[model samples]
Target chain A: MTAYALLVEYDGAGLVGWQRQSNGLSVQEAIETAATSLNGGATPLATAAGRTDAGVHAEGQVVHLDLAADLPPARLRAALDFHLRPQRIAIRAACLAPEGWSPRFSAARRHYRFRILNRPAKPALEEGRVWHVPLPLDAAAMHDAAQALLGKHDFSAFRAASCQAEHAIRTLDRLDVTRVGEEVVIHASARSFLHHQIRNLAGTLHMVGLGRRPVSWPRELLEGRDRRRAGQTAPPEGLVFLGVDYDPPLPWVTSDRA
Target chain B: MTAYALLVEYDGAGLVGWQRQSNGLSVQEAIETAATSLNGGATPLATAAGRTDAGVHAEGQVVHLDLAADLPPARLRAALDFHLRPQRIAIRAACLAPEGWSPRFSAARRHYRFRILNRPAKPALEEGRVWHVPLPLDAAAMHDAAQALLGKHDFSAFRAASCQAEHAIRTLDRLDVTRVGEEVVIHASARSFLHHQIRNLAGTLHMVGLGRRPVSWPRELLEGRDRRRAGQTAPPEGLVFLGVDYDPPLPWVTSDRA
Candidate 1:
């Protein structure tokens, strides 16, 4: 059996997160079913870099699975995407992972993007895809305040109540906020994140953007390490799992084994 | 009665074109109903700069209506958007138009954008928003071919079968094609266009991009002035009404009556 990593993309609307759930469809189930179909009904276990919540989107999500049958990278992607029909999921690329490389672990960093449509009127073209904050937001102010939470720190204040992480200490590599046209985009990167950490950070910084809280407020919340002291968790619709990065970039050469 | 112009935007996934149709809901009917609700049950006629086909989106559509009850520009926008409820249409801006101004006839130029997802994988995040062309596209080649259609011309070759234009003579102000990441964006501008003219132009240019036809093919088709000689009309989903341009730009100063 050979382990292969698949670059994935999906629209998370109407999905029950990335993991399989009894209530509704998940991105993982769709991919696994497709992989199984490709292998003639042998179920495959697909693991992802991030298990995102429902209503979240992914432009460059990464996943891995062990295949009993060896196929070329292009053929694997084409066959997988063919069976993943009707679902808003795509297998962008398929390549061999270095021996035991796991999408969940053995990774360097994860990147996320949160979009906010700041305007007096609600979004029409980007309704469900963006968080419509109908008030004028100061993006520059929000960017300045986000710096307070950068670097290694205990992010207990931003942790979700249902978080299962062993510890609250994690390093936030980047938090950038910028205005593009009528939208304010927030980009967050880290090695790994506590549940709802990015959403909570976005929510807290939003207060500063709206001039409701001072720039020092998020710092105080971080130092306090109390979830209640932080602002509300931003909605899931606006957040997108951009992708994951590994220390040594995974090499890609078309396998001769078709 | 005072004439007010509105800058509108909408996601046209389920809309039945801009004009009111007996078959399904239309952007015009929605806006008119909203206007009637604001006027306490008097239907107001709404005229758009362009009457787009079904499934055509708009980022900056312009419309105008004569209101019996005058309100401030901001208030007018807010009230209409409130009444327009639940629909995926947004009144981006509302302001007074010069007396007797009509959105259709008073416009100097109309701008449109066509989006093509030129990739092997189908779209996930932008499913219904773009035309997915699986083959690799040569954007530079397409742009070179598009220059053949710029300036004044008899566009009968690109006109729709159902087009009601009295004459086929029209001025083509600009046509630009550029690659943005994996997407090829085509921008077209003119004082006006025949029904499906831009879509046909895009379709013809697409052949050039794919190397199926030479760059000189579109110019030859233009010289022919026969609709059958042009390529197929591009899908409606990829088209967007960017906005309308008016000479001596419409004044937006608040009226004293409002």
Candidate 2:
């Protein structure tokens, strides 16, 4: 058996998140089905660094799966991409994995970007890819408020009720908010995230950006540790899984076969 | 009667071209229908600066129309936008046009951008918004070759066969190509263009970027003055009408009611 890692990108619209469920089609099921076809009837389980929710897009998602056939990385990637055709998914690259490497548990950080179209008119070009807020937002104030949530803390106030994680304690390495033209962009990085943590944070910061809450609001919510007191969870359409960073770095593989 | 100008933005995925046609829904038809309803059954003809082809997007298209009702600019804009819902079009701003103003005739320059996704993987998020080219391209080479087509010249080589322009001579103001990460971006500007000129130039420059043609090939094609000698017309999906420039600048109007 050969362990391989694949870099994936997908549009999460109309998808049932990353996990396989009987409810609807999923990113995991789609990739696994394609990989199984290539493995000639043997099903291979694929594990990703993050199991993104439905309507959440990804630019650089990492996945690991073991295949019985030891095909060249380029050939396997091309074949898998071919089978996954007509679906909104692409295998950016594939490479032989280091022995015992895990895409989910490998020691490193993950990054996400949340986009908000802060304009009066509804989005045309960026529909389904951004959270449209007709009201003007103060990005600088949001960035100031986001600073209070950085570092280690019990983020229970921002954790989803359905989150299965045992503990709400996590370290947030970065949270930045900036305006790029009509879009308010927020970048967040951490070792891992509890379910809906970024969305919750984005929602809470939005209130601050709109001047509905003071800059001290996020810190107060963190200390209170009450989920109901926090703002509404921002919609999933705006969140994107940017990429993952692995410690000691995995071998960089080129998609070019030549 | 009020002569009004609207700044428009739209996603060109489903609509026909800007012109009104009997076969399919066009951007012009969508706006006109909405405006006519607001005008109480009287149809208002809309004229745009550029007649963008089907599947071509626009960031800042200027349009002029005359309405019988003399409503406030912001209220009129809001009403039009409210009626334009469920369609992939937005009225960015609306204002009273100066007397005798024409969107097409009074334009000083027009800007367009073409995007090429230079990567091995097919696009997932940007699928229909960019042209995917699997082969590696040298953006610098493309830019270098494009410099030869600058200034006034007979550009019959790049004009489409069906182009109805009386003369093939046009003064090209700017044609620049640059690489942005995994995408190659080309920006072009001119007072006017012959049909399919930018696409043809892009396709020809693509050959130079691929090292398939010498850097001097664009100049040779231009001097040859043969439409058949030029490269294929790049697809419409990759092109965007950036905006139009009017000299003696029109008054800037804000969409905000306050």
TM-score of 1: 0.96
**Chain B TM-score list for all models:** 0.96, 0.98
Off by over 4 Å in 2: none
Which candidate leads in lDDT? 2
Error of 2 at A4 (Å): 1.0
lDDT of 1 by residue, B125-196 (tens): 888899989888899999999998898899999999899999999999889999998799999999999999
Candidates' TM-scores? 0.96, 0.98
Which digits, one per residue and each the tens of the lDDT, describe model 2 over residues A1-258?
889998999999999889998999998999999999777698899999999998899988999988989898888888888888889999888889987789989949999999999987888889899999888899999999999999999999999999999999999999999999989999999999999999999999999999999999999999999999999999999999999999778775646546
Give the fraction of native contacts in model 2: 0.56
Instruction: Give the Å error, residue B6, model 1.
Output: 0.9
